[model samples]
Target: MTEQLPDTISRLYADPGEYVDSDHPAVEAFARAAVPSDASARDKARRLYTAVRDGIRYNPYVSMRSPESYRASSVLAAGNGYCVGKAALYAAACRVHGIPARVGFADVRNHLTTEKLRQSMGSDLFTWHGFTEVFVDGAWRKATPTFNDTLCAKLGVKPLDFDGHADALLHPFDGEGRAYMQYVNDHGSYHDVPAKFLMREMAREYANMQGEDLAGRDMEREATEQ
Candidate 1:
């Protein structure tokens, strides 16, 4: 039997913040469009998961220097973002509809990276890979909406799907059944994205890869530059 969650636990997941701005118009609109007013909690969770998974383009090269980039409303307005930004948007969207959600982070080794991005990062190790942990059906289910369907098609990887009752995590193997991403370190979960903590780790881990001047560097350019 599923254990009952206390009110405090639910509140923790629904709490809003600078990063998880559930009250923002953008987030509210996002939630409403994804989830129908008459839908059940499970159906709402599923729709929201799919909306976030495919709606926003996944570009791992967004700037981490600005705090605005990490905000859920900002990510929604931009229409594209990295894993962390997308995760924040998903969590915020969930919270806006009174569904409990939180952000989760871990370091991963991506085995299938584009040539440009792989070279730019100088390593396969990706720090602070983000996903959403949504409380649904008396439990928390994880989903990674980092890779959009278009990108998945391009990369030949199967798109991740969420059903609300199951964990929608990254596939251990790709479409060809080859090894994909591997999680190395889990930084646990939070109600909001910890920008300073994440940025510090990114700056430290990707300093050389990001170039000498991380503050002024445009990460998108680095990912695109041959």
Candidate 2:
């Protein structure tokens, strides 16, 4: 059976929460412009995803958080943070617009770019970042708007775009088959993503564990010397 989103997700859109209804500015302006009664799910989902993607960035500073002070408009206002920040903005907008959305991640074997960069020194970097997953007509589609042009240019990649309907012409990675970031965990069944605020605690947990294991081996060697 296909996955179906809860009906409450729709209710939330009509009866927005404190943040969505308030004139806090961050989300107020964005919510007004983005949501349209006649727009299809794909149109709203794509616009929400792209709005965040084209607005925010993929910084390492912002904490892995659900929408707090930041919402759809936050990307337009503060305009910082990385994947996590972008994902939060995207999700908040989707929820506000009655589009059921969730966070996701992929273990990228290689982050390909139009050209190689100096910062990409080592091999197999696991930046288990955050993105948004929206339930369309039948299937759920993945989107990452956080890596906008500025960040992509710095990282030597292209900006992925998503117009209000179809995916925009700016998707960075090739998502068809080759450049796929593997999805092993079915939403924390095996892996964890911090965005969900549940089942998955953090996206970096697995990567952090690997580093600890290496440290343990080095410690053992030093103990032998002592």
Candidate 3:
């Protein structure tokens, strides 16, 4: 899409749907708690990125059971989510604070995924991996709030960072110098998460990991065992 006017972009970023619900009380409260009134948009975006990155525990064993699980407020209230849920929360929180934000997806290979998960998913390629693109300083910057600090440490991979300027993409190597991740395909950005598209992709790509849904699957245990 072409560059949108600031007001138009802001409107596009705000949503009241199953995913990226900025109007929800929990998401509003979270945005309020993560950033102060005096903070600049860049500062607020950084704080929100950090808050979502670390605050929400990442788990993939659970199912996407219903539309509610995709809501930013719902994910915030639950205190844990996978990459999609975490990114949704970050985008929602940004919109709640009047920061233009959108969700972007990519097919990633060899992320800090565990052997069990890799086998369960039948491949190392994870489709629809989510991230936030915050509009700030006259340009949109990408940030991946997945893989919290502890998880990064456990996986021996450097934690990703975003300064509200450069893109905080996945690292190309682990701590031991092994190739860590690569973005196989970019699905572009969207004001709202394409939930049906994501679900269908998950169903096709993660059939072995599915269990009625894909929300709370325990990934920490697998990570720890590695």
Instruction: Tell me, by lDDT, which candidate is best.
Output: 1
CA lDDT of each candidate? 0.82, 0.49, 0.81
Superior candidate under lDDT, 1 versus 3: 1
Tell me each candidate's TM-score. Answer: 0.91, 0.57, 0.91
lDDT of residue 5 for candidate 1: 75
Kindly report which residue pairs in candidate 3 clash with one another.
61-217, 62-214, 62-215, 62-216, 62-217, 63-213, 63-214, 63-215, 64-214
For model 1, the local distance difference test gives 0.82
Q: Which ten residues in a row have the lowest lDDT in candidate 3?
A: 209-218
Best of the two (2, 3) by TM-score: 3
Ranking by TM-score: 1, 3, 2
Error of 1 at 84 (Å): 0.5
Give, for candidate 2, the lowest lDDT window spanning 10 residues.
211-220
**Residue lDDT tens for model 3, 107-152:** 9997558887787778888788888899887778899998888888
Question: Candidate 3 versus the native: TM-score?
Answer: 0.91
Pairs with steric clashes in candidate 1: none
